[model samples]
Target: MTWRLVRYELAMIRRNRHAWWTLLTLAALALLSFANLSLEAARANADKREVAAAERERWLGQGEKDPHSAAHYSIFAFKLSPTLATLDSGIEPFVGQSVWLEAHHQNDMLDRPQQKASLLQRAGLASPAGLILTFAPLVAFLLAFVAVAQDRERGTMRLALGASAHPRTIVRAKTLAIWGGMAALLVLPLAALALMVAAIGGRLDTDILLRVMAWTVLMSAYLALLAGIGIVVSLRAPNARIALVLLFALWIAMALVLPRTASSAVDALRPLPSSQAVRQQMLDEAAAYWTAEDTKRHQAQLLARYGVARLEDIPNARMAELDMVERHSHQVFDRVLGALYGRVADQDRLFSGLGFLSPTVAAQSLSASVAGSDFSHHHHFIVSAERYRRDLVNAMNADGMAHRADSNERHINDVRLWSAIPEFTYPEPTLGGTSGTAIPALVALALWLLAVTFLVDRAARRLMP
Candidate 1:
């Protein structure tokens, strides 16, 4: 009986020209998004390689600079594109891609791609992920909002209920059919993306494939929730139009208004200081502290901990060695900056925590996280870049310390040392790592799915008569 109803529902959807047209439109949009992503990914990869080559040339060109001077003239490292970044772009386009690793302060990533793009990119184009995760679900809502109400208005519900078919079975069949259509709309574009990536010599990870599958399941579940909500509204409302209005209002609240409001509230509650301001303040404080007598005593203590009797007695070479020590002092200042930055990130996490109240937000956040497009993913990139910076600077400083005997020594310049330094490389984090960070959002989605399923069952029983 359920199979019969499912077949009937599928046939009904196929016969609806509007539904077919909407699905076709969605498929077209998804394909376009995939193309855009592939183009952008190719561009980003090319840019990264170019920058890396330029850095290599510049380092090798530094004929015979002292190792300490090389440390002070550290190279910039660009973040590499993740395999799945093309699908979602996420914060990659908005955040800076490259970091300058000079001797002192850890520089923030600079040159946001979004700043170079047209304004429309900021509002969001119909990216494949966005179409599936966002727009297609809305399209499903449009299809389902009048699924039962139209039948009732036309007396089909009464006729069906009078037959041997159970109302619960009827609702389940309807949901399954609509969900099938939604899945196709989503999967077609993703299949195209897979093909495009394969054609471009990109390697796809099994974990990424699994993440995409999970994302698909989440999207389908969200559509099911919307379908269930639509049925309940249709059963309760007097007419199809009212059912749509109610569903639209619900969609607005969940999909549109709440996420932004929560984000705004979180910002107000825990404001983050600008990166520029943070950097400037750290530099000022470091200068003041280094100059102060009490601060000098503290430095003396640090040097003592390192088993050094005096600054000159410390086993190091020239003015360059002194510069390296000054650089280490700046590193201490950066630690203070990192603590403050962590506080702000904690506040952002607190905001993301509210995803429980809105499943749309939860699904969106979880999808992005699993795909490595979330803020945490970007943060990991920045942190990785910083680690590389430290490595590069330390390598150069070690050479400086070995070559020069005292702060007064004019060191021999050896450009060969500069060429030997390793170029920075960025490794994209795994989906498993990012998904672990997204468990809360996934749980929230599960709870909402359960709640909607329960409500659908309850509503079906009530509407049976």
Candidate 2:
């Protein structure tokens, strides 16, 4: 009986011209979004390679300089797009793409693509993930809101009740039919994305793919919950129009207003200091720590630590070597600034925690996490980049200390040393990392789905004879 009902519902939907047109419009939009992302990815990849190659050439061509001087010169590492990044884009478009790595002081990533793009691009060019996570649920709500209401309006509810078809079964069939349509709208583009990645020789981690798929499933569940809520509204309201207006109000609150409001609240409560402020503080601390009087004492301590009675007595480039120590001191100051920045980030997380009240917010956050486009994933890339910078700079500094002259030589000329520095390569976080960060949102989504399911069942029982 449920299967018959589902078939009937599918037939009814297929016969509706408006429904077909809506589906076609959604598919076309998804395809267009995918194409845009693909083009952006291609352009970004080309730019990265070109910049990297140019930097490498410049590094190789530098005049012979003390290893310490070379370390100070630094290099840049550009963030690469992850295999699934084109599908989501997330905050990546808003964040900088590259970081400068020197002996001391970590620079924040720079160049937000969103800031460079036009206003219309930012507002209307919905990411593929946005369409799936935000729009699909609304579509589901529209389809299911009139499921039982239309029956009641047409006097079919009486016929259905008399046919001995349980309301639960009827609702279940209708939900399944709507679910099928929503899934098609959501998954087709994602599947195409997977194929595109495969065709491009992109490395897709199985774990990450699974997490992405899980996010899609959760999104489907969220839509199911909305559909159930819509049915309840339909059953309670006097007309389909009223049910739709009520659903739209709920949608606006959940999908549009709540997440932004939560983020704004978090920023208000735990504001992040400007990047300029952070850099200025580091500079002030370095200047104060490297005063002439303090420098003499610091150099004395370095000589003592190396078991040398005088700076000149030490083998290798002692003055050149002291530069490395100064660089490390600057790095310590950077660490302090980084800690301050992290505190503000914790506050932002607390703000996002408020999304548990809205399933749309929860699902959107979870989907981005699973798709590796959330804040945590972005931070992961940043942390990794910093670590690489430290390693590369330290290696250059150590080389200078081991090979440069011990005398107060202002510079050690060594072009080869510059050529030896390793370039930065950003390794994207695995799916596990993204999924782990998204756990809170996923839990929230699950609870909401369960709550809605229970409510729908209770409501159906009330309607039963």
Candidate 3:
């Protein structure tokens, strides 16, 4: 009986031209956005490879020079776009894609795409993820807002209530039918895209497939929550007009207003220092701590270690001083940069916590994390780059110490030493490692679904014509 009623509701929905048009329009937008992003990601990855190769060539071909000078002529580490970057560009547009890994400083990533974007692209919704988050809820509400209210207005809901033993059963059937339609609208194109990618020889590895599954599940739940809310509101409203007004108001609050407000509130609460300030702080502290006295003390230790009477008597004194400077500067970078990263994490946590109020926030957070375009993913690349820089500098210093002459001769190294430093490779982010943001987002979505389900059930029990 329930299935029969669901079929009936679905049939009625199928006959509604408006619903079909909305679904088709949204699907078109999603696919177009997906295709555009996929192409952009492909181009970006190709460019990254080409630039990285050129940088390596430049580094290796610079011929024999001092190892210390070679360290300063370091290569730039470019970040490759993840496979799922097409699904959600996330923070990738705002955050730069490459970092210079030279000695004595940890540089921030450069080449932000947002700087080159036009006003229209910046202000409007342009990505697949944005389309889904903003429009999918509207579509769900549009379809389900008139579910019970229109039936009541046309004098058929009373007939529906009398046909079923309990009002909840009829309501449940309608809700399922509406949510099922939304699920189809959401999942079908995604499935088609996956198959298309596979047909084109794109590798959907286990991890990528798992991320896709998780993304689909989360988006489905979010759409279901919206559908259920629409039906519940429709059941409680006096008529279809009132139902739509209420649903549109709710949509505006959730989809448009609350997200921006929450972001502003987070910034107000945990504001981060500017890049200039951070750099100056690092330089100031490093200079204050590594004074001439500290350098003299380090020289004394180096001489004592080498069983020499003076700094000049110590073998490779220049390399020893360079090594000491690099080691001490590491402490300053950790202290200053660590604070900056902590604030970023705090802001992220605060924003995620705001998801309790807006499911859009939770959905977006989860989407970005799964797509590997979130700040956490970018942060991992930066940390890795810094580690690589340290290793490269340390390797240069080690070579200088091993080969420099005692007569204050200029020590030169060839391509052999430059090629010794391994090329930077960004490690892939695992689901477990990125769960910091994803887990919180998942929890928020679950709570929203659970709370909405309870409201839906209560509305079902009190459902009237």
lDDT of 1 by residue, 1-465 (tens): 787887788788778788668877887887777777777877887888898899878877876766667766778788766666656666667888788887666777888888877654676554566656556656766767646767778888788889867888888888787777777666645755654584465566666676666666666677677667766777778788788788778777877788788778878888888777777777765552345674576656556655776666656624433554566655765576667757656654665577788876776677677667777788788777777777777777666666536645645556567766776777677666632445667777888888888888888888754
Which residue pairs of candidate 3 clash?
none
Query: Who wins the lDDT comparison?
Result: 3
Clashes of each: 4, 10, 0
The parts of candidate 1 lying over 4 Å away from their true place are: 195-199, 288-334, 406-408, 413-415, 434-437
TM-score of 3: 0.94
Q: For every model shown, what is its TM-score relative to the native structure?
A: 0.89, 0.90, 0.94
Q: What's the C-alpha lDDT at position 330 in model 1?
A: 56
Error of 3 at 281 (Å): 0.7
TM-score of 1: 0.89
Tell me the tens digit of each residue's lDDT in model 3 across 5-95.
Answer: 8888888877788986887788788888788777777788889999999998999999999898898888899988766777777888898
Per residue, candidate 2 scores C-alpha lDDT tens digits across 1-465 of: 788888898777676667556656776777777778777877888899899889877777777776666766767778776556666666777788888877666777888888878663586346776765566656666666646666777777768878888978877777788777766776655655755564575655676567557756766687677777776777667776787788788777777778778778778887877777777877766653366786686777777777878777655645544554656665765586667757645754564466587886676666666667767777778777777766666766566566536465544656666656666667677667542545666677778888888887876776653
On the 0 to 100 scale, the lDDT of residue 397 in model 2 is 57
User: In what order do the candidates fall by lDDT, top score first?
Assistant: 3, 1, 2
CA lDDT for candidate 2: 0.69
